[model samples]
Target: MEKEFYIDLIYKSFSGDLSEEEQNQLENWLSESEANKKEADVLEKTWQLSANFSKDFEINLDAEFAQLQDRIDLDEKGNVQEAIVKTMPTIRKKSWWKPLSVAAAVLLLAAAVFIFNQNPATAEMLAMETLEGEMKEVALADGSKVWLNENSKLTYPDAMNGEERRVTLTGEAFFDITKNPSKPFIIDTRDAEVKVLGTSFEVRAIDDEIRTEVVVKTGRVSLGKKNDLKPIELTANQKGIYNSKTGKKLNYEVKNLNSISWQNNMLEFNDLPLEKVLEDVENHFGIKVILENQDLLKCKYGSLFPDAKEAEVLKGISSVFKMKLVESGERTYRLKGGDCQNTSE
Candidate 1:
């Protein structure tokens, strides 16, 4: 295959312009060998880098293109083969400010050369998340740590610079921020901004949900809205809730830090509705517990389940509520029964 044809296919693939035949051809070529796939990867990365190239540095295009063209020619003629591998180092050393014939040449050469040599870790920002039934631990460059809850996402820059350390959160996460008195740590949720110098806290902010919650485990945290000036400050064992639509703050204190008991693989239900309990179970265990009768959800119970198997918890619930547990599907169960008041064994 002509090398330019593959290059054109790479451009089309990145631009989402690949037709069925072109996609099939590219896939076939890629599957033929690992080298072809690596070549494709290089081309794709180059295309992306060219699209988002930082304008801070001036790139030399004419000299770079000529050097690249020479390598291509040598490869085509099967001559000067020893120089092929050395072309990358030469391209890396080329100045970015040199004059080019056209913008197209700049994009192609800069992308193909600089992108190939760039370190992926230098990217401006990184995003992380936890899938269902999984909790993840992430250490930021600034020494802060984050424990992402199941089905949660956190987006932060590779390095924390500027006047403040900022991160965006969706769903829930427990943060253990490293103390930097000059630079306060700020969390941007859907409804509120949580500011703390150095503290351990939990933020729960679900998209489209009416309320955003923050619980400070240690140190202090300030909760404020984007449009409001008076921020609600809370200390350890204190909780704050922000109404997303109404812009109201509700602050309170809890008896213990058991609100984050899930960190220890424990589920604590403090007289919560059965419906909410089942939802928490599903979120933590990655299962579906369907209430066969909606009325059954009215039953409320409080208990602590520590590292117990799903079956054991299900059996306990069945005995407590006098309900029947039936298998609906894999990792799914149906609870069938009428609502019963809290029963003592």
Candidate 2:
């Protein structure tokens, strides 16, 4: 088999593009010899590095690729292979990126030369990012489930073999962590960190963000600054916030249960002030709500909307408040002709 055939197949395999026969062929190739298996591993590792990498700058790609080309060259004529693998690196594109060119194949092969040469601690972990308006669910090696909100990024090891199951996060994600008291689950958000033995929670700490928050859905979470010995413990139905600018650590009872509504699109308000309720609605549907009468803010509302559309939810709220719903503009609304009342349901 031509070396490029295996390279293309390997890329397709990682991308889930391989048909049943192609998958079997790959398995057969790997089983043929340990050399084939080792080469495949290295290329795959290189593929992961390009996804998103910022680490050890020791091994220069040009120098390293030159060395690898000399060794891995199978065909007596190695000039073509040398030129293709010399292009710029592109490991990751989208979540499930496909093969690009022979150049990318060579890049992956070359990167693996140094990437796996380093110790496990120095290896660049895999990264996943969701674009805006896209949500993704990921399962970790430790059996934990992560529901990543749109515009969020998660960096995790290929396997959870350390004393602690650790991951780094940017943006927001709801975690249904697998319980493992021995190996606590830790999420590092640059300035802040959340340690958990086994619990479910939602964390929001954007890049260069001020407020690093964790809302506990189940179990307990220890929230604190990165590398800080002293941390605030949060229980279920609790929220912890560490403000980097103010250097303040705050713990509060979780009032809004639908804080993870992005995962399920469920809106739940428990006797919340009209002003606060509208804020959540606006955030979910990206629709701005205006109260024609400030008195409406005095009213408290309680309801549960299960997978309801924006229009349906707004109509329900209007009926409950005895108000008229007016569409002011695209993705904007006005609640007028309403009287303040204890609208609890």
Candidate 3:
């Protein structure tokens, strides 16, 4: 049988277009010999790469196949150079009349790459930005959310369809990422690379500043510096600070809410009663908080609730007080069943 039959089967397999019978035939052929398996592997890689290329440019498959056999390797200008594929017999045939060897398959991929990258196009970059005194909320395609602070910029692909969801940031932003263990989220900054898999955190990497700070609100975040500094993992309320000028990394528990309140609408308290915290939340987010048990109010609370959402602030307060948060009325939450005896600050 012509090798095109097997190559067709391999390409069909990638798109899940093969029938059970075709699959069986392909499998049987693959198990026939090591050479066949290796050839199939090469064909599969070529098909995938060419498929990606085809999305950007139309594929004249027959034309590509015919020309690829004639030469290999792209010049500095991405023009195909004349290089003979020794495996191809000198007796040329018509469009796909002859079977494609593994070398030809490899050459076809190279041609597609050169042709696709011929002009050397820059990647299409998309950006979301916030000006001075402006705060913007952006929802990512991956269900991740970002609250960009003033003078901040976040540039990312139209689709974060890679092994990792990556974006570049300049200035401060709070990210609430969707959990996908298979795909980690990465934030590239001037100083470090912050990686996470489903977490809520704030990253401050201003252009004019030498300090890059990451404060984790929930879940875990990995902070890796561009320099030789060791990476650090930050958990709930943990802060990681990297000084690019000093080449120093410092991580500690989050103290006072710093540089994030602009986006969070957060209320920072040194050491205040739960009642006072809720009072500030009420004023900040235009929400009211009711305590079912009066004792819960006496429980002192002081932690950063760096989420712009009103409910989240109340939820954080209730969690600290061990109270059940209930949205009893519009713009009002009732903290049900709580005690000061088990309170934590």
Candidate 4:
């Protein structure tokens, strides 16, 4: 078969515009060899994804056509170089049809690339959001998973179409990525970006926060600004912090065992101080915990509340420290008591 005929067949197959005879001919050709079948399968799947995305996202055809025209102009410029060489009678005499054949192939290949790229469409962007006091779980198209925290939003593509599986984050989320060595998963945030092959990690990029953070639970992650040349890399049980204002890699930490605790609906205090425990509680419940008596911050508490309510956690902490828990304002609570080493409970 001629190369142009095969290229046309592939293009027709991609668009699902192939006639019955053409489809049968293509199917027979594919079934002829394993390699051919694989190529056809890849093309079909990629085209399907693009076709679906194109339906949802209206492409700027005028702009896209303009870009294609520019590329074609560049290709024509290359043809001009071939024209200069054509002036040589000896080269022309050596092969009368060779130059024409070469030019045809070049133009055909360029046209194929431009047409394939333009019609399949760009990646289809999708998003997930959670309200205050709510959390959501998302299953990505690539078999990866995400746990979106309260008041957070995550934007991902319906299909990961390029060299990387990229998603944008606006608040906090825990990602459990599926392994795809050829295509690394990337989390894009306002302050920083996180890249990994197939890893589970937590990313926090709250709008008002002074810093954006990445806590890796498994595998390895590269964390820094999206365009940073040398982003800080982290492995399991490691964390990377970035200063939002300066866009600097602030620091790295080695422990983040409870990074995904909130996803499990569990609050764990492992020999944590009263001050830190309150901070965690505040973050988890979107509430403020204040110490009316400054000395109450000195207490070290250790406990676990699995699937516990907000009131239960407050009451538990108050009873153990012998502190008075009082509501001061909406979504705010105060701990009034003495400084005591309350590691007993």
Candidate 5:
């Protein structure tokens, strides 16, 4: 394939534009062999470097194009005619300022490169971590707070320098963002993007499903489709759950104000189904609980329990459901098969 074609494909993939087939093809091209993977890695790294580098420097497109043209000619092995034809589009957009602007931009980019390479520890520090069975808290340079759930990871700049504060995450996290009207805070995940000026929200992205559960604990936040368009604006006391794969969003009034109490060592549930409750417990405590009875899994319950020992919590759940709890192993707990006689009030 032509270099320009590959470049366009890369750009489209980054912008989330390629169709499923095209995406598969691109992925195959990227991982087909060792050579392809190396090329893709180089391209991806270059794109990342260009995206994050400080934009103070001006760029001279003409000079860069000229150098590229020379390299292409040499690599084409005397196919100068085909090379010129391939580069015609770029050649047509010539401007006198292009060369000088590119020179200035290159200088600025070089300085940024130097700074980025100078500090290895800072680069690692910018990455997010989620310990097993523990939530990791991060205090951003801008005074924003982020709580990353177990088995989660986030990446951000050590410090924000310019017009936008951007971060990438995998798994789940809760954000208590600092207000900066001039600079919008953006969280990018595999499923969707959450943007906020100042607000508190929870985002969960896992298993091809992206759920941005936003509750404006303080200010307003806007949830939007990542790499696509503007999201619906959510004010205080409003919540939105977005599913990226389906492109469906469910919006509702924020209920159960104690939703985030789990972060403070409290587990409060209001009309939550047993399955969801179990999911939360497993996530919070990092233990696996298996329900032997499928019917009980669908039952809904409401309760408040202190974030105490796992055994205590399990015992409380068993009492509420009138079910027997059997500890199978160190990390395994099973709710024995049973049915509740009288529902707890």
Candidate 6:
């Protein structure tokens, strides 16, 4: 059968409007072929997600029929009654395709309404996405899971099957993929790709400027630019940063394979400049910092701050360098006369 015909049949089946003959035909086709089964599964899951359909999987065409009757009654009794009745003959005389089309339209509307009213948390489970500074842990339709990080979004089909499990990602996320050697998990990030059968790894693909970085905490993962089909594999405790613009891969020297520490609100920097540190503080903690002296921008320093308090962080910085830190407002701060140069090694 043609793909469109099966697609239409799947929609009709879920809508409880498929005739007995059509239902049997669909079942036979799905049973006879793997390709048909996969397509049916995807369509069924899509319908479930889009409509919030119950797991019990019973569709009442009678209820739909009742709704149609109500519409007919309202239209007939209303001011357009005569015109509608006059038009009824035309509708009734429509070809077989007409009734199916009308039924599909109504079912689509009902499905849309069901999806629109779905709870956001439930929707997230069905299709995970995160905004900037937003992090979440989601369990997928499969036993696998993901930890999404700041400014990231992920979209997967409602279900997974077949030889490859595919998902689209934007920004950053960590995956603790369950081992399924038969079906490798593939993450498409537009410019880069991360493929693995089972592994725990972090992928950071922010703006086009920053190189896409993948840090493998366990197992192994393959990373490559989207256009580059061949992937560079990273073993445990290894980090690979792919420069999107130049397509160069920078392999960072590995030390430990700890889970990403951003959640603890602690940032570990080695020999990073104070100005650069302040930039991170502003982004994660949501505050603005100003340095009065241009030279201070080059001063290197390191410290840990509770990701919660911007003021306390400034205080710590001021104390460390003997500088004066002042808060201008909730959004802005200024630093002056920090013995930053003298304090540096």
Report the number of the highest-TM-score candidate.
Answer: 2
Cα RMSD, model 1: 26.7
The whole-model lDDT of each prediction reads: 0.64, 0.68, 0.61, 0.64, 0.61, 0.59
Candidate 5 residue lDDT tens string, 1-345: 665666578878777788888778777677757877777788789878888776576766644554454344345534544654787686446342132221100000000000121223334337877877678998887898888877777677777765777777766677776767788777766555667655456655553333444554445556766555757765544455555434655444432434454555667565577888888788667799998887887677777675646778788777777778988998999998666543543
TM-scores, one per candidate: 0.49, 0.59, 0.43, 0.51, 0.48, 0.49
- The order by descending TM-score is 2, 4, 6, 1, 5, 3
Candidate number that wins on TM-score, 2 or 5: 2
In order of listing, the candidates' clash counts read 7, 3, 0, 0, 7, 0
The digit string of per-residue lDDT tens for model 1 on 1-345 reads: 876787689788777889999988888888988888899888777777888866675756643554554445435434323433556565335242233211100000001100111113444767887898788998998998888877877788787765777877776677777778798777776556777744566666565444555665555667777535888776544556655545566565433334465665667665677887787777666789988888767678677787746888777777788789998999998888855668521
Give the range of the ten consecutive residues with the poorest summed lDDT in model 2: 104-113
- Candidate 2: list runs displaced more than 4 Å: 1-124, 244-247, 306-308, 326-329, 343-345
lDDT of 4 by residue, 1-345 (tens): 754575579987665788889888887887778888777678778877886663477876644654554455446646655754776564334231232121100000000000011112477777898998788999998998988877777788777668778787776677777778798777666556667744566666655444455665445667676578988765544445655445555333222245456766677676676788888888778799888777767577877787858999999888887888899999999888755755454
Question: Which run of 10 residues does model 3 get worst, by summed lDDT?
Answer: 105-114
List clashing residue pairs in candidate 2: 50-91, 50-92, 51-92
lDDT of 5 at 244: 45
Worst 10-residue lDDT window, candidate 6: 104-113
Model 4 residue 150 lDDT?
78
Question: Which one is best on lDDT?
Answer: 2
Error of 1 at 322 (Å): 4.4
Off by over 4 Å in 1: 1-136, 148-153, 160-163, 170-172, 179-183, 204-211, 215-220, 226-229, 235-239, 243-247, 252-264, 290-296, 322-328, 334-345
Q: After superposition, how far is residue 213 of candidate 4 from its true place, in Å?
A: 2.1
Model 4 misplaced stretches (Cα beyond 4 Å)? 1-122, 131-134, 208-210, 217-219, 244-247, 254-261, 286-294, 304-316, 319-339, 342-345
What is the Å distance of residue 155 in model 3 from its true position? 0.4
Q: What is the C-alpha lDDT profile of model 2 across 1-345, one tens digit per residue?
A: 776798789988878789988889888888999999999999888998889967766865644654443343323224433533663153223221222111100000001001111114844487788999998999888788888888877788777776777887777777777777788777776667778744666666555344566666555667777677878876655556665544566565545766667766888786788889898999888889998878888688878897958998899888887899999998889999778666453
